[model samples]
Target: MGSRICVFLRRAGWTMWLAVLMLGPAQFANAASPDPSLVAKINAATFEVVIPRADNDPLSYEKPLPLDLLPYQERTDKYFSVGTAFAIGHNHYVTAGHVLLAAVGDLTGAPALRDANGHVYAIDKVEKFSLQQDFVMFSLKEQPQGNAALATDTKAALNSVVYAVGNALGTGVVIRDGLYTSDTPEDENGRWKWMRFSAAASPGNSGGPLLDQNGKVIGVVLMKSPNENLNYALPIGVVLGAPDNMAVMDKRITYQLDVMEDTQTSTFKAQFPLPVSYADFSAAYMKLLYAQGDEQLKKLLQQQGNDLFPHGAGSNHILHDTPELSLFPELIVRNRSGQWSYTGRELNRVPLSGNGYVASGYVGHNFLIHLRRPDDMKVATFYNDPKQMMDLILKTGYWTREVGPEKIKITSLGNPASSTTYTDNWLRHWKVFVWSLPYINGQMEVFALPVPDGLAIMMRMNSSMGTHDSLADMKALTDFFNVDYGGTLAQWKEFLADSSLLPEVLRDAHIGFDYGKHFSYDAGNISFDYPSTLQPIAPDNMLFMGVGYYQDHGKFALQPGVIQVRLNSTDPDRISAKRHIAPSPDLDDNFKEAWGKLLHKQHPYDGVPYNDGDEMDVASVIDPPASDAPAELYTAFYGTQGTHKPEAMKAKLKLLTQQFKLKTH
Candidate 1:
């Protein structure tokens, strides 16, 4: 979701990164290993950045992660090492910015440093940071004894012998020799340069010191050039010379919604007084980040108004959709004439306890979902619990821990570590839950919206990187997601009672229904009511509410896009009222033909009956008011297997449209 942070996406960049990290057996120019005294000095200064392991119930696996997969001491350690860092001015410690950000939203124990002796020290405050350069300078709560500060150097000659020093693969701090190959300008504005080197750095090597032949810190080892052996580091001078007491997010993040082909770029920068605690720093940074993300998202939708969904040539089919009410959560895919249309998936279902089945499918990379509730699960109970949801996911073989020869099954995700709610732009409410899979360094994020039958869930699984990435990404992706809510009168009563679960619009809206008698819905802007005379008013009949762009009093906003009342699933006797936005460029032939038919008073949009067709229906359009606004249409329709005459159709439509007015006040 934030490809802006993609630069930091090199968490564990596969074997190619490892290839560059392990720089092979040969030292560049046949240089000797550093002196034992210098090695001791470097080792003393280095420490691994780590997060303590969560106290998990022994995972339900046929065979556990072999204790032998790791060194005896490491496997027995109390904390999990992530990256590396080293001391400079007694208390001043420096590491890669991305390494420090792992703590930004991590609910795990605070980010700390662990030494070779297994002593851990907590970080006290951030002194300086540069996202573009990918570096951070901070200090410890209490400095470790016996570790001397690192001597710094600003430059290293090209082709000179050097060493990549850090806890490679989290094994422990080790020194690997290589060449200080060359220099390349930094990507943004050529403000600084990156020291390209061929050194044996690894996943745990990041944020550790890149040292010169004399054992002086020349740079902070960062990332590897994926296509070549020339890996990179930030010259130590940059970290040393950065302005005192400041933090800057000067990175370029490219954000694109799934619905839009175009991307928006934010040179996202937020500078503030530093010397701040990690908690405050993280909170402040995220607050600013989400603000930017929200603004950018809105701008993207408006800027592409002409080409975005409901406007472009590709979205033609959706405008005319009469697809059956679906319980399977579907994604909007850009069709040929389908600038956007719901994806009909080929899902694989796995049975769970209590007659529940997990229907799983891949929407795109790393994105997945399960549709509706199991026959035996309760709407309120299952919708309110996240563990039950993930436990079902685990049953499908989706959540597994692979260690040595074992693909260990995780029977339960336990309770969620964090749970909250996110409201989308369309005023749709979704419940958000995050589960930590500590063994895999992974997190699973779930966003569940209540549908008529049950919940339509969208989930994201991310691993190896910091656990917060999944949470941050899922929240952003919620905006681009699609869902429709409806249910039998009984389901609606239970669902609507939880005001905290309702979107703003719905929190104030009401639906009053009495089985075998009448059904009614009333929101501030729209209302509809009906009796058994108009249609079958039963508890099991489906009533659906959709969200979309509504033109109101000269301003466009999100409101219930449509209100549909179906007497039953099989009956052709149904009533619907919906709004249509006039296309921007008016390019698509479908829209052209649609507008032609509407203007000429043709079959579907005209108040007359076209009974010979499969879609036998009568409809009338209420044009937008003559006020400051774009062209819009509100149509009330009645479709049945009963009548063929215009008068009969109009009579039913009149009953349907009596309360379907756009009330401005």
Candidate 2:
């Protein structure tokens, strides 16, 4: 008989071996609770398998290394190996495809397994795996005498408590309990559906058995939540239903880049090959305009035509006929005081269609352009012209769609004042000269075009992997990303010790900017936390979540769903909670207190002032806010209060200046 059968016999308990045959219905009724003897028997049957490296001896090359190294033989041992397996029938066992991933090496290579007693057995045959589920089964070369094998069953109660027995963190067998939470339906990826539970798991727990009350396996422990106690398991039914061939597992392991094509006009996304900075963007626009040969036109307008010149063939005749001409002059002109301007001049004799005209405007040190159409003077392009030279500005200024804190409005120019006889002649020829002034330095045109799906992924990558100039801040970003991705806690500590990924540009920008300074959590989605920044922008789909660098911070370039959670809680009033891991005590305290006060109502606290360091247990009392509330309410409550207010408004100005320290000067 196989060892698996022997293990089953031990679990059945010699005294009750006959009872299992007699009490079939009774056993089924109490399937939610496992027999203590069976639980222990299952635990004992689980073994920690360690494979050792071959020594560098001449004889070693001629022969294969032994299957198992003795505990006393330290020299031959290499890296620690730990995985869990359970008896299926006699000596046969089942495990995850990933567990045997490294062991199997190339196809057709035999894997050797060792029993707890140090006995070695060759893998006789292996069955294929459930590609979607990542599971596999193999039989041992020899079967143990006198043991029965446990069969898998798909019937499991929803919310029923289940136990997972596995080798956790390379330690011996341990069991954890949780309710069967959910089964995700087959998605575009494949037919596999994950079985979710609340059981806590660690690194070495993969491939272990998630068991029902009767000690029957329900699923294989696969992965666990990095931030919480949730765990995921692969359903055992997938393994039971899999075909004989295992080649499918090979294809499933390979990563495939799938670009999803979006058909919605309102939901298009585009990706650029490289990241463009504000300076680069500005330079590109300037270059595009310069290439258009507007410099010569600009010089001609600067001449300022004189009326003393005589008409053709008459020395005494004053030059009264100003040619009706509209000149598009693109030049960077600075007055004596170092102010730049954009000049568009039309010289015309008639009011509507003039003889000589000049339209001139200034764009400060930076260039600006005013595009006009005859029908509607109200709709025109103003500010720095992005299309004139480099196409730096993504879209027409008039095409702005303001949302959130962005403010966009069009103001008409006052009627032109009548010019004196001498100046009138200069202006008559300038019939439809339009000019737009640059309003703000930080402003940039947002195109109506869609943000590409790939852009979000790229942004995530930048936020997680990009190098920052500040060593301390770079380490923090790296630590956050690594830990946020399920990397070991030790890996987070190691990231702090290494600063090779820090970039030079970021370091230079940090010198005078107090790179280490950080902001409050509720101060919008953008935060300045030293060597790194966090920009959490709600994407086009208000419900869709993403991160971006809207200001001076870096961008996120990782994919969504890479680390997604439902974020569900029983407390109805605690709709959402954002936690920031800060470095200093004072900063952490301030944020915690502020956030706490904002979320919950404070009591008198025995008239001891809210600042007294007394702890209050608010977790149970504060319920989550209703989900139907407007998202903007939360965003506004979190971001800077006066962002939407115009800078010139006195009340808003005072509020921003006094409360947020905004400087208009």
Candidate 3:
């Protein structure tokens, strides 16, 4: 009896273990079945929007228009084409902010929102709006009856399956189910955090409710991924927690409006500002030079070669050998308003020329400073700061010039006492200079041949004009100018001063350069990894579907279609529908089976026309009369190639044509 009892107990234990292994572990009781009726009821609460075109009145005008005005110049009515909304309260509807923004314009031009039953409703007022989150709440003039409103729930269990019922892709009412995903922080536009999910939401689905298994509203379907099955929603808890008072709503609205207006205004200003006159530009240029560092100063000088010498030698002579000398200085007399009235002195000295030509020019007089190199056409200097360098270059009448292939020369005027002229093509390159002079209305200028290719050099010359009657008289006046030989100086200067300036000039000057090693191109193309199935969409037109899944809210995603097409087409007037055909859920299994069959098949061209070595024969068999092939067969072949070794197949085709002369024959 004891042995029998023990046997019975062991047998029961083994049975229990087998049952546990078969059934797996127990789960929570929250796995309630989804109610299809609830989805239908929720969908019934949603409405399709239709916008009517505005009438054109050619004779009507607020103000008398000119008879010569163009047709496009006349103000025409604007209207919204399509949008979506859902009932939230007795007389309130919720939709995306962008949907209602266009409807809030001038009443005469604004469009009326039409419901599914052709009932036209006026937007009484927008109760709340969040631009960042793309949400809008508006009250209707009258509410429709017989619609079942969903009850909002603040807390939803994580990973719970949820259903999104809305007019996806303008296909009327549809349902998509997926589990709750995660949430992202509020965006920069004061939008609340976004709740992420796997349920798909497409065009015309915004403002629809995401329902739980119990038929409660868990979130508002807002966005979705364009390339994937990811979706996002606005949590119902956040919507319920939002401020409901009029004062609070008004403050929020005003703040957002201000922020948007400020941003738009700033962008406009940056893109298109008031133009500056030539005279005003000169003054600003001077101020900029004064504010720059040594490196920037040198660069500024190097950029504005010939604009500093209006009456001096032409650019060809002024810039002849001095590739580095951007501008030459001239003295001029000016009135109280800073207008030049007379010439004081002009300093004409080409670098390494060994000749000093001076003309009487006054203070404040504008002159041209010229710079030219064989490789680069010409450039001129138009303005200078601190004005000291201009004074020295003008007074000294000694400029540096380049002589041989790669040599700099220094030339000096014949001394009256010594009656000797000296020219040194191999003068020791002086990277520094210091000079002091007695006060006078005279100016000095400096010039040099292409200063070590890209290296820019800054110079300063000061004078203690003995004593003057007033500060104005003693003030050191200088101007830099560039001389263009054939109107090429301006273009060169503009190119050098462009905002996208090269970085090579700004690099440390201590590093020596090998002139022989200079090359034409410096940067390479930008490359990155991207999924083969994904493609960029045009943002201006067509309709966006499933754009809320990814963190990128404004961008559209990949589309599932026979031939891939961008979510948004380039045309602004065209509306596109999301293609319904997609791979079956058992796509992976189907692919494996199909691929195995293809791998086992023998080549049909093995004994075709010509020898086996002739690739044309293989191509002929594979491409066998497209007209005779069924559409499905073509699709299968193309699709299979696209799925496996696409690049390799392309290369093989190219090789057959290029190397085997298949196409040429």
Candidate 4:
């Protein structure tokens, strides 16, 4: 299972793992009914917390269903019931902190209270909040008159009968009875004990009141243990003892980066005066939380120091190795041996309409997605239509959400709420899309790389990931991602022409061609051209552009360092070329020495054309006019049926580099 991430990129969420369910209604466990008079008093004090549904929200599913399948109020309701809250005093109301958080970043609406007779009350101020204890204290703008507050019992005896009361599943006040079980320690240092009872609490029971047999409030219902029917709640005593008019957060977080196995645990603590409106509280909390994320990320990187990616012993081999030729979207993770390598092929693949397919699997906190176009789909349409692409992906690999036993397949995501292409430090361009998921109170972030086959995507969502700076985190991880770019001649044409979809650098490194005639590839500092005579062009002929990071450059350089044009998709007969940059000190000893030999022209194969038997011809030049010391050699080779001599290979090299119009960066 992935981190339940319906998080952010530029926004927030360092999503975590917990059994606690979200805003969905909780189950109510019935052990015994509470006193009838007490029930009436409690009902008047307690109100259902609801976040109004957006009027503009529309869900497009795979097919239409019978009108009766969904309740009329559910489909046409103005508000969505999340949890419950009740009066603690004349105007003071209390609910689980997580309940208010649903409003923190929500655009649909802030939380409000709904009475038994269908009246609504707006939340006025957040008097207090605590993340760890999962509680929030606030007041209503227009408090209901004559609703008596529920009395609190700070020292209720363990093993006594208690009533779990709330607007069970939004059907109005319902009280269920269960024995007050033994206390359970809080997760972080056991700072406090939670009241655990064998109450059959369901989803909607969260934030409700857990009362004693006398109907005195003892604790606030939070979550049910996923393993058993027992439930957990914050002892009412803790809430009463907490200082007034303050917001405090003390939660333990395990920092997890996607590229490595290392983790660091730290407690996030912050405090500030409250009694602020929902808007002010949300803004303040987001600022502090995002800042905390940045600090923690920086601290973790600092703690690892040179042992992190592109620095430690693990990255040495990958830094020196040529671009990984495989185009599947996969993470570059540091293996147990302390060597960085691409995640393997144990991914889940699902077929799409056209022969196209999507593959996905976990990589640390994130997941990698590769969407390949079906052979029958037009390259241009598939490459440009991101909405269609994502729709296909969601329908297949991810699965549809269930609406009443009917699995509703998402038909489309419409347009991205925001779209921008970010070029990472290594110069890899990622098309970023943030789809507003207002219905869920978050956004679906996507960072997609345009590859030859299709899009290589990253980002977050798995509602459980629970908020963090998802955008910034994914962008940060982009540098460690390793992939190649390859496509057929037809794919190249469509991909290159769509300037709206092109990355900054790719626009300059134009892949100019004419179906079966002249073809050329240009990089910022190098250019190569070869006529169709070398390898006749067909729509299916593959062009594999190897991209690698040259860290020796002041800023890392990720470009098409090597090029191979093969005959059709399967034929080995091909033409290849590379303009190499000499390695820095980190490379293996043998590699450095071998390149040194080539630079000095000591070996026959060094800058010398040769036929290495397999009917393959090769030649290399240590440094052409535009290249310098660190920029070592340029080579071009071809493999054909007929035996070729040194002269033939040199001719091809000259043609490839004939147009040396490279502007060295």
Candidate 5:
């Protein structure tokens, strides 16, 4: 059976508590009265949450209001009992996020909780929360008279007897007992652990404290699984041991609430804590667009169409067409057949008829995922640690520009979360970072996920600075992201190999490249493997075969690197078959011809030897098995000594000899 969360709130000064009981301590068989001292502290420390009474209430924890509204504003008394929460840290109380969500509809108001003594304290602000873990931490506007000590250890022995304390069905503060059975995985990422118990808990028991024999809070009751008697709680250590500090002024969010009548499922709207500003969008967009060592990204953009970027510069409309658009709250994709298809996945329960929404923005394009990196790259550098990765982005100027060192605001960092997904072959950890980019005038995010035995898969999402509701859209994109983790190493290598980046180097490493079919140079009676990266340069006025064959030229130019070659043929001995030629007669008077296939020691100046300059190899008939047919000349030019390696040139010359065929006249 599906799991049900237990958390409730009331809208008045009087409050009550209930928690979905997870593993609880065993009740004494003799059923004697509990220790008076412990009970007194429990009664003093625990409080009942007050919320509005609504039939089939949708559990939500945000009190969304206009920006002008102050925190904890006044509201009417449509109040009732939610689950229980107990004070822990200095003036702070902890409870399940879902419980507080019950009274958190579209209104802004301070929710009060009443202790056993009927004294009430207002919840001041949400300090921290974990959506994956289902917990929320907030402080009291005024400190309570008493509070409970929290447990520090995360481990609980199997079958340990624990007490499940909560406001049972709003009757009063009640403590039940159950055995801590075992731990279970609660999320797809397998990074979080939940406590399981046999406690007999019902609706009003959620968000209450699960205490050990010492009465120290160990876990917070969450919900129960419908399959059996097992209930679940989040470990108290996890709630306290979260990775980030509670430093932001406000940590609450507005959510569109949905609750199923059967109580089988529910969905709460989620949004980014801060909207993406335009500067943030520009910075992130430029970084991905100009990412170092990302040759495939360029090709992928090219495949879509060159018109997307006119004259090598991105158009303003590009902001809407880029991959970052996937992070939008509303993403509509156009299929290959020219028909638009809705690819968005909702985080809510299965949609019932007309209640769902389709995202808006740039509406007619496909989101192609670039999920792998080069094999030679270190995967650890991507996201082994979240902060380090952020530092890298900052260093790359992906977030903010570096002008003055004193302008750095380290304390500005906030909104950190870890997401993960696991399959039999892979365990993926996505360290998520959300921040405002003043330089780009927008809010941006980075998802650094490492691949096993490969490079890191980094994805970026950006949005306008004022638009904060895009979590649902991001979830849909992440669902699409999971598909690539299952991609094979061969695919990644092939993707790199297919690009114009060091393809030959990858091939030498046994990562093969397919250059398609060889272009026939029928005019020169020669054909050989040509790199796919070479582009045909026009010969508007260039001379080849007395200018007659210029239109049928067999020459091409390499991009990103300057190098050129032309395929032409002459009589068998046009240049020289000799291995070496002494310094030219114009430069050195007395020199002898050395015999070999390549002619060596030639200079461009013809009469001068400048900066180790020399004329390279001249193709000729094979010396060992001299051929009788016509031999084509393979002449090449190199601007620098190191621009092209001599051994590589030799290989190309040798390949031409092997594959070159002489067509009979």
Candidate 6:
């Protein structure tokens, strides 16, 4: 009973009502074919204009804004249904002007037409358009087979029976019967007449052909009116009679679409989060790496071809990347034809909404992603380090993870000569370091490559969430890129030196130790000093010596372990009194009974007993040992669990043992 006119934007899940009244008898001699035959022929020429969308955009669920003054809404998808357009001339399609304007926001790709045969063709250019009258004509890149006829006798009597044909609810072309109610002036001036009809025209039905009882096209459906049983269509006579309307178009129409430049490029599609094809990959890559008008990047893309992406996702839904975190933003290939091999199998996956096919192709175990925003360069730099970069990327919300350093074969490019001294050169020039840890989800390895223009590639091992360990496969990938960089160490260094985004300092702050920076642990009764930086934990029932910072991936720390120096006040547990204790004793015994093993083989200094055991030796000291009273010191060293290896633990234990001493206050 109440009515409000709404523009069609392809919203799904709404029922439409249609009304048609028998036209007042106005017999015309030129009425053509039977309704059924004409309807069949017209329907074949109709097609659905579809725009490719990401899985995340809710194209079909959008609703009209309740108010007019609200801020304009934007969608992330490339295209959704605009009011339907039909082929009117060879390779020419026409649609409501408003519909085309609303659908092609910041166009990333051209709108495509899917005909009754399900074949798609790209819209090339606007041939005609008029904002005042609401109509647009465009040419298609691909030739269409047929076109619909425009009525010669444009006038329709009141109450004429008519049929509406269009893509309703994006399902397909549907023909609905309704009544031609009356004629009304288009604007306040009444310069032209608009045909009013009761044929149900729902969202996605605008710009379709309106026909008479004998199936001759009469008008173009444009919009629903705010009155019951009233819909408006531009008269066919108005469209066909005005020659100037055919050339009317807005000259400033621009789109942001990513499409193939030519026919030579083939396409390859995989599951979601993966590129649809070679063309899709190239288009996305070129968009991020090049500025809006960079011709050099375009040339490189055309010349490089598949060489740019030598690796492909195979059968596996999961793609394992190189163990190092550098291949993410960009891959630097030494040879133009370099390719990658991965261990994964392709499998069929059901298509998601909007996109129907989950095509099978190369699925890798890792994701080498590259992302950039045009506004990122506006800031000095988005992040200071790889950890900061990762934090910024995952900033959709706040989250954290623990990490630690791991050693791997590091090389720049494919040069073996530069590989001879890879470790030092890599750490200095590339800022290449590996941080690994057991994340909240699973094991992960992070590799960061400092690229130009605030760009970086973060390669990680076993990065895919919810997937089991793929370290073995990741190692193979890492080895491939390690030797893939074609440039020498000097050339790489020069590039980093010249890049605006690379930090001035390249040394990693989390690895190695300066043994000259001594530290002391004073426990009132017993105290000593070690050569390296070791912090002190309060002496408990057993005195504990804390060394280096070890937290959340061991950032800003090196060779972390504890030096426990226990004061066994009882003589029976003292090492000086028990020289006959077994040379090789139990390691699990408390510090009181473990003194023999802690000091088993060294010479004494002055009167104090000392033994720098093979497993335990001297560390360092900033100051001489000091105490308030004579204290019997029994020491044991232990490394933290997990990646803490025994050989590394033994080295630290020897340093602590030799540095262990008891002083009289």
In order, candidate lDDTs are 0.68, 0.32, 0.34, 0.71, 0.40, 0.39
lDDT of 3 by residue, 544-563 (tens): 11100011134321111111
Error of 6 at 191 (Å): 3.8
lDDT tens per residue, model 2, 29-140: 1223367767545643454333333222211111233334334333333322435566666655777665554333211122344444444455555544443455657666
Clashes of 5: 53
After superposition, the stretches of candidate 4 with alpha carbons farther than 4 Å from their true spots are: 1-31, 65-67, 71-73, 167-174, 181-185, 198-200, 223-231, 344-399, 451-454, 462-468, 490-531, 537-541, 553-555, 578-636, 640-665
lDDT of 3 at 437: 19
lDDT of 2 at 519: 18
Ranking the candidates on TM-score from highest down gives 4, 1, 5, 6, 2, 3
> Can you write out model 5's per-residue Cα lDDT over 230-336, one digit (the tens) per residue?
88888988888864433112122222211100111122223223122223322432343223213332243344443222211222121111122122222223333
The CA lDDT at 635 in model 2 is 12
- Candidate 2 — number of clashing residue pairs? 77
- How well is each residue in 216-299 modelled by candidate 4, as lDDT tens digits? 889988877767767888898899889898999889777767777787677788988988998888888888777778787878
**Which wins on TM-score, candidate 5 or candidate 6?**
5
Query: What order do candidates take by lDDT, descending?
Result: 4, 1, 5, 6, 3, 2
Top of the candidates by lDDT: 4
Error of 5 at 286 (Å): 28
Show where candidate 5 strays beyond 4 Å: 6-34, 52-78, 147-153, 244-665
* CA lDDT, candidate 5, residue 124: 67
Which whole-number lDDT from 0 to 100 does residue 477 have in model 1?
58
Tens digits of per-residue lDDT for model 1, 325-348: 455666666644436767646468
Identify the leading candidate in terms of TM-score. 4
Residue 391 displacement in candidate 3 (angstroms) = 58
